[model samples]
Target: MDLSNIPKPIWYALTAFLLLTIGYGAANHVPGLNSSDKESAENKASTVPNSSSVKVSVFDEATQAPVVGAKVIVESQGGSDTDTTDNLGAFRVQIPTTDYVKVRISKNYCEPYNQDLNLKSNPDRPKPIFLKCSVPQKKYMPSS
Candidate 1:
């Protein structure tokens, strides 16, 4: 009926109900505002680039210091060479979205080191990952 003929409380309730219904319809149909879009965005965000390269660093096991010139080899699960480490004991290696990576760090002063890096989740770019190595100190014999 007409607003002037309806009771005031009923009029307010009807108005509130209509406003809520419009909002619900718009929220369901709008692309950027719909729940489906939010769900899709979350799914996309979970996806990782398999071909991306991640940077990892090697440090001395004893002192936790960066071991420059340390030899590091990165091999994938498929027995393919990804990349090699730099002089700073850092390596930029291209890995898969999910991979079993092998990291070998060695230096003249340290014992042979081997590590297995499981890269199932694609870590964001330029992330620094620290690895452990077997570092040995040189023995000093007094001038005998």
Candidate 2:
């Protein structure tokens, strides 16, 4: 094709289109460049399963009181899901598939908890997972 005959506007438009195509391709492949909404949608689609639920509860070890607003995460070879504890300190999350997964729970002013669970045997009823918080140590100051 002869490029000398092409108009300036047409060349500019073609250049802009080519640049846009390249940018879009790079954004999709580069980490953190792609929009989160699209990434989350893909993750959800790939991790979908027949559906199973797991309940987790967070509590203070010394006071034996429920810990509210705790974050819970369930991860497996396939994918992972996250949830937060309610006022009752309980969080229920849906599992993508019936497989072994690692459950992690964390809350402010409390110790984090992690455990590997096997969902193959008990799919319906899973034992409640508990987390213990460590007492903050008091700092001693020298007498002035």
Candidate 3:
């Protein structure tokens, strides 16, 4: 017998293991090599319109600066309120997607303003809207 000759079963087992590992990897990686395993509609629909966030800010119409500690109320179809603003005067609110309706801002020193909003609205991304404080009428101007 030749010493160079080795057991056939051991070589076969090694080859099989290597081939199995390669096949498994290719099946998962290769698109055309394996059957497609895709997500169902329920998974996507359940996550659609996932918007539930709103941003509110208060600024002086003349100064154009953020109003810190300003009171902000966001009334949507689902009725939601935004979290209090930070030192920078930025408030973020989370509401239902279908609830995108209107937003109201109030402050003792300034007038209140209401705006209609929807999920399509882009408020979070640095938008500036002018709001003027209510001016008191002098005795010279008579009320209606």
Identify the candidate with maximal TM-score. 2
Give per-model TM-scores. 0.45, 0.55, 0.49
Tens-digit per-residue lDDT, 22-124, candidate 3 = 9898776443456655743312322335545566566678777777676766665654554445576676665557635577777666777788765565645
- What's the candidate order when arranged by decreasing lDDT? 2, 3, 1
Over 19-73, each residue of candidate 1 has an lDDT whose tens digit, in order, gives: 9999998886444576463444322312335454556776666676776776666
Q: What lDDT is obtained when candidate 2 is compared to the true structure?
A: 0.73
Best by lDDT: 2
Which segments of candidate 3 are over 4 A away from where they belong?
Answer: 1-51, 123-127, 134-144
Cα lDDT of model 1 overall? 0.59
Cα lDDT tens digits for candidate 2, 1-144:
789899999999999999999999888745467765554542352436665666666677777787788888888776677867879888666656667889888887677888898777766664566677776788999899
**How far does residue 76 in candidate 2 sit from its true spot (Å)?**
1.5
C-alpha lDDT (0 to 100) for residue 109 of candidate 3: 63
Candidate 1 TM-score to native: 0.45
- Report the lDDT of model 1 for residue 142: 92
